[model samples]
Target chain A: MMEPSTDKAFINLINQNLGIAYKVSQFYFDDAENRQDAIQEMMYQLWKSYPSFDGRSKFSTWMYKVCLNTALTYLKSNKRNKNEPLQENHYHLPSEPENNKEEELRLLELAIGQLSSLNKAIVLLYLDGFEYSEISEVTGLSKSNVSVRLVRIRRELELKIKQKLNR
Target chain B: MDHLEIMRNQWQGSGKHAEFTPFQENEFSTLIKKQMKKQNHIIGRYFWGTFLFHILIYALMGHVLIKYGIVSSDQLVLTLSLFGIALTFPFTAKLMIEFKKLAQVQRGSIGVSTIKSQVEIRYGILSRYFRFKKLYDYFLIPIHCAIGAVLSFHIFVPGSFSYVSFPIISVFVISLASCWYAIRSENRTYFKLPLEELKGILGDFDKK
Candidate 1:
């Protein structure tokens, strides 16, 4: 078995990929606890499988696959869907920013979380600088399918942002 | 700027979300180590279980053969029993490697969806071995028992025929029940309605 990397190497990798965990968790979960649980689970799965990643793919690409797969399966099978929603008292979403850009960003996070798992994958890949071919490779979708879904995602987010802004 | 452009910068340079505070960093690494240790313990437990189970099976077979006087104490019942026990070693080693790989891949504690998606992609290969394990549990034991039943009946109870029906019927019933339990375990959650109206409860959070 391949030994774990030295602490310096491991820390470097963690610092690089940690954002992937946060973004993926944010996309899949609305509640902070769920997000944390999802992140922890993904990390657990990644550590479990990290050694055999034979450098064929970029490390980030492999990391994306590991994170997305873990989150999707967890969201699909988890019993948390049945838990009562947090009362309005539970979460302290920071006060809404006065600036339009920051408010939009905040709303975008919430809206994106509402997307279906597949759409979230498309959006995340697109936002992360993946071209159509690359997104297809990561997600097992055809390039044409990725393109078509991305159009739909853009339109959906536009409508959602407009409605939220007007309200 | 278009929404796409703004979102892209936020997504790409979203370093704040990705960056771990010192406390979170410590907690996550510790959790990963604990998970690895648990996996190693599970592998060791399975190894001993496989080794002990076959030994007990063979010992019982030996005792039966000796009591019936078909073979002396020094004689082996069948070389096949030893071969069957030998087969478990390869599986045990493969499981160890798999567990090791699983632990190493998760070193950073990334996120849940990515982890699950990776596992699903790899499930194609993993499922094959799991299927073999399920077969061993579901089919192998009863077949072994059936063989013992037939051999004892043929050798020691030539005149009695009542025991023959018990083995076939009992094995079939047990196998069916086990299959039913496995299917039920997979399907149990599909029946519940989830707490889908969280937005309504969160109320003004949606407005903000």
Candidate 2:
């Protein structure tokens, strides 16, 4: 596995799934610098954990698991200051929808960003089309709990998205 | 209707929600090299370095016992050194055992079927690691200091300066106190927050 050809193959596989890191980091970090750092850490962790891949699960599923786990464990560099009334990272719906479609997308991001860190991971999995079992397996929650949480999360998200849309 | 349908596109490939810069092999190689440097384990180095210091202290104490003989004026300090070595040896061994456990912890939890289990496993290992470290800091450091202070004072300063024996006790107190403060602060800075965060995450899981 340490051979040059193997390294190239591994790198190629990682390159293909690099989007997982990008998306996971986007959900996890508020600031761009921290997002960049998160991506690097996730990639490094993926490489380190690559040998244990076993190929039993789909590579993308495994990649998401590693990325989510890394993000969960990563200490937030932008943790709110106790005295500050403003949260620089806090999500806000814009006063004016500059462009209808972009605003909807932005609102979606804001609503999701505002979820609890655990919920963020859950919703990320759901929106990415992961099954209840797959989400439960990655999150360590029971299948029933995953179903329950997703139902609540979906309802909550839809309400927010619709209200923001004024539909 | 899947009102949340639009969000699926948001989470998937190369969207405004998720921006990706393709992987650069050179940047990754540099980062990988840096991580390789860290994988050398600074904590491991520190412990081994401390172990080397212990070896030196042992040699010094052994020489004093040989040079001064048990019945000499330095008998009291020799006996104290023996006591220090006895107490310190067990803690040193415990620290080494903890070190090995730490190595395993670094390897991280496997079969991460659930994120909760992974967090819990890491938390459990790290809490145990910090506990062992705290015990070593509180007990072993003081004992080792006493051993070193007593031996160094005896070996370097002969009978002519024996009247200054008060200084040996004073020096031991000062070193022990300073080390106590230093280690306490270090633990506070490094261990306190991470452990609390881990605990909080576990609590988040349990609150369900």
Candidate 3:
């Protein structure tokens, strides 16, 4: 049982870092309900594991590990059930009534959604500005593996975006 | 300049606009408690369900011993009950231990190695149990039936053991062959893909 003050502190911390949850959930789950469930599960795991935080790493780094792990587990379990259809390319078309920036961003999201789960994770971490070593640490991939994968992922994304632009 | 760079900037920028319903402290605490309760329910169900299944098996076996009274002596019944318990206890204990290990896995602050090890342990336990169960059904059940047949013939017919043995043996051979075929098909269809996926996940960590 957490003390009220500790609970409040934890709540504040989560509130501050909530964007990490949002971004990670959005990258993995296309639908709103699954995204919400993923976020809730992530927060619950973070709260359950909060007492183990030893201040050795940045809180965001620790949070990223928890979030990504939870998201991957969620995705796998959902796949087993095969209940909900995965929401691919659910974004508005480039011709929709949005500015070019929003359109391009939607295209990029759709393209990322097309990548394999592992590649999607690497690209998301890369976009979030994690160094290769940090990506390796979080993902359990060796640094060289992370480097090679990132180059391939970048080229894959470029090809995907180019195809989207042509369309 | 780069397409990827542009996407990253957009991610950082539009991420600010990702709307979420922020939870207050009390609400967050309530949510945490609710989730914890749900997790406890899932874990508790698995543990108790397994426990009750073993108990039910023992109860059924005891009922069989009482109803049949094949050996008119209480000592024989007690010995058989003890033997049944001894045979089943190992499997029950192992399942309980695996469930406990699964429950005790550190939730939030777990490292990659810890996660990988836990998953591997779970996969190993489950696949091993599946194979063991298949073998038990294929071999042990028929053997138990044969023993029961011989004992019943010895008690009731006194000299018809030879007569009963032939049919029992035939039944046993047919069932064993059929079970082997089923287990082989199940290994191919049910177990192979998931085990391969688990192995792939474990292999990711082994790369230098």
Candidate 4:
């Protein structure tokens, strides 16, 4: 299953783009165990899908697509997952942060938790600096749809975050 | 600042969204390999597990029919047994074919596809399997009672046919009805809900 040259190159690419898995899982899964499961699924998928990387697009772009796909289809185990509160410990997300940033992050996460998974993915991509076209390609939504949803998501998120903060 | 502005500012400034501790080469490969095995094994177990269960039931039924010596004279009873097996064949075939397709889909490079396509594909395979299972259960529940009725008449009563079979038939019918009720209730709650949730997700793509 491992070809030396190809395997070497795949591992290198995965190591470089490991952040994609961490970030997507961080948003999609709230708790530690589910995050771990999501990461495992994404990593396994990325490995299996390495040969299909046509190199036409940036490696990160392709990795986002795969990770997002894995996250969306991660339904079987998700049914069994408990919807728990966010925890601080993670491989990438900092264990400690400045007080304001921590408060903001917590409020942001709480508001984000109210979203459906698809909306969460869309919002995450937009916040992470993905253009409408890339978000469209990853989500299979039209560019116009992405634009429209982004507008709505921004409003909804602001309302929810404000409400949460006030409480 | 607005929510989007704050998010963009924090996400980009902190680089937290795009930062991770890199995995060592050995750790990366080993972890991926282990996950691959666990995931594949879990899915594989379901398919083979159900296959084993259905095979066992069929073997036991076949053995009982032969043991009763139905092959010698009771052509109608033998035909019914054969028909029951034949009816099950298509459903079993559909199950195997669908499971194979699902396995191929998992092993294929479908991970790079769009998220909508991925969810749709998984939902599609699962819903189809559920549909077939519901239909199979419908046929199986009654046929089971029918088999029990005929076997009781042939084996215990020791007669060519009589009004005495009516009591046995009543018992089997009641059992069959209860089985059907239980299955329908279970399917309505369990199967329909998840499929509806998936459909609801698809609906979100179209929401105004």
Candidate 5:
């Protein structure tokens, strides 16, 4: 159990870092309902494991570990029930008129969705500005392993984007 | 800009266009509490259910041993009971260890590597358990039939051939064959798929 003050502080931290939840949910899920469920599950896990957050790492770093684990677990369980096809139309891209920037972002989301689950986590961590060591820490992979995966992920993304742009 | 940087820039700006439903703290707290309670209930059920099942099996075995006496004239039955006890003790010990690991996982604060290793260990344990079960099932039918035949010979045809009757032998062979087929089919459908999925997730971490 936490003191009221501690609870308040934790909630405040989450409030500030809510963007982490949103970004992760968006990257990992294609539809709004699934994204919402992922966010809820992540927040629940974060809260459930809140007491273990020893302030040695940045709260966001810890948040990344918790959020990514939750999303990975969510995806694994969901995969058992549904075989998601990798089509851009399946993603809930912003429903507004598609400008060039929106198209690019849509392509990026589609590309991210198509990556293998572990690769998706690596790319999301990379884009979130995590250093290799930090990504390794959160993902339980060695730094060199993270680097190798990141290099492959970047190449894959570049090719995916190029193909989409050509189309 | 390089492809990576361009994508990173887009990722950073991506949320700007996303219209997230604002999270209500009160509602979230309520949901969290409910989820926590549900998780606790599930853990409780699994732990207690396993404990009760073990107790029930042990009690039944105890009753049989006490009723028949440990040193039975039927040497085959005595040997079977002793074999069962041997298997049960080790199985119970392993189950306790698995339950302890599961409880540790439920009680949070562990690192990602620790959790991953725990999951991997649990998977190994389950895989081994299934393999043992398949082997046990394959042999159990024949063993039981042979035992039944011995008892029947003692009752019906005293001082005769102490082997299984031809019909029982046929049934035993057919059952053993079917058990082998079932294990092979189930290994592919029920076990291999999940094991592969788990390996895929763990493979990245294993590369180092």
Candidate 6:
């Protein structure tokens, strides 16, 4: 029987899945401050649902479900006016210093920024090498629908990335 | 290379980092602890509230029966024994299940909202489903009423004597008042986060 130390167990599990939080947060917000908020909100959700994680599915799968769901919902519900510029702390892109990957990351970030929240999930899963079936499992999408969305997403991302690189 | 492949490389190369970069280790731990405590507090309220309310209901019933002499002293012992054995475990189990259901509902809301926006459908039926926390509250109400009924039985029964109007009326009024206050206070506190977050998010979603 598992001991009921929720705090200890939850913190450990979250630490293991930290990358999911980072990726989802990065995808959701351009500003550093907003990114942090998104990450924190995601943490809140994960911890709240920690008790129900029976471990039948992989931890990462459950986390992906939690993280993607939180990010998209948070984006939908974000009430801050777009007209207002982000405070310096809030408007930040993830840094990519000292690597051949910088330009690629910048371009990719731009591409993600252009997608709707749901489309972003499909793209993230696709980019992460999630097959249609796995993507459907994590996202609760039908396999056929996941395939269809990924096709559209590929077209959209290519156009967006090309425009960014050209600029 | 395909768009998906290009993104895969970029995402992999972006690297990984702690989510709580802005906060020091101590500060981050403290924050997580505070959040965990808050959740426990909410769970405790629901559990104990159900427990106490059930006790109150039986107390009231016992009192009325005893006053009428419809029940002997030995019968009082039997009723308590049956209630303790039969109801306690079921109530706690139900609360645990309710907690799980509540979490699922919350997750479901986020998932549905995300899918809805992506598919770009004009309308959806999610609003018809039970909100996670609201369903939790609904389940809590009957448990509380059952507890109150049990407690009332114990409290208002007139064993040796048989006059009931005043005591029964007062007991009912007191139970109703207490239940109302508890419901109002707890509902206001429990809903503060979801409603605020939902309203803000829904407002932004509407603008799109």
True contacts kept of 4: 0.53
- Residue A129 alpha-carbon offset, candidate 6, angstroms: 2.9
- Model 3 interface CAPRI class: acceptable
Model 5 residue B100 lDDT?
A: 65
Residue B87: error of model 1 in Å?
Answer: 10
- lDDT of model 6, residue A111: 62
* Reference contacts preserved by each model: 0.27, 0.29, 0.28, 0.53, 0.25, 0.16
Q: How does the DockQ of candidate 2 come out?
A: 0.32
DockQ score for model 3: 0.37
Number of the predicted model whose TM-score against the real structure is largest: 4
Per residue, candidate 2 scores C-alpha lDDT tens digits across B101-192 of: 76643322365446787678768877898888888787678777877787776677766447857898899999998988887776765567
- A1-167 per-residue lDDT for model 4 (tens digits): 44212267777888887888888887777667788888888887777777777788789888888887777665333543464434333224554556865666566766776687788889888888899999998888999999998888888877876786677
Candidate 1 regions exceeding 4 Å error are: A1-5, A29-34, A37-62, A73-111, A114-116, A128-134, A140-142, A155-167, B1-19, B22-32, B41-56, B69-121, B134-139, B148-159, B162-208
Q: How far out, in Å, is residue B84 in model 1?
A: 9.1
DockQ of 4: 0.47
Show model 6 residue runs off by greater than 4 Å. A1-5, A80-105, A163-167, B13-29, B32-208
DockQ of each: 0.24, 0.32, 0.37, 0.47, 0.35, 0.14
* Model 1: docking quality category: acceptable
Tell me the TM-score for chain B of model 2. Answer: 0.68
Candidate 5: stretches off by over 4 Å: A1-6, A73-78, A83-85, A93-101, A131-133, A140-151, A165-167, B2-4, B14-29, B37-79, B82-86, B104-106, B112-195, B206-208
Output the worst ten-in-a-row residue range by lDDT, candidate 6 chain B: B121-130
Off by over 4 Å in 4: A1-6, A75-79, A84-105, B17-21, B24-26, B70-72, B109-111, B157-166, B174-194
TM-score of each: 0.58, 0.74, 0.75, 0.83, 0.71, 0.49
What is the two-chain DockQ of model 5? 0.35
TM-score of chain B of 4: 0.76
Q: Clash totals for all models, in order?
A: 41, 1, 0, 0, 0, 48
Taken in order, the candidates have interface RMSDs of 8.6, 4.3, 4.2, 3.2, 4.3, 7.5
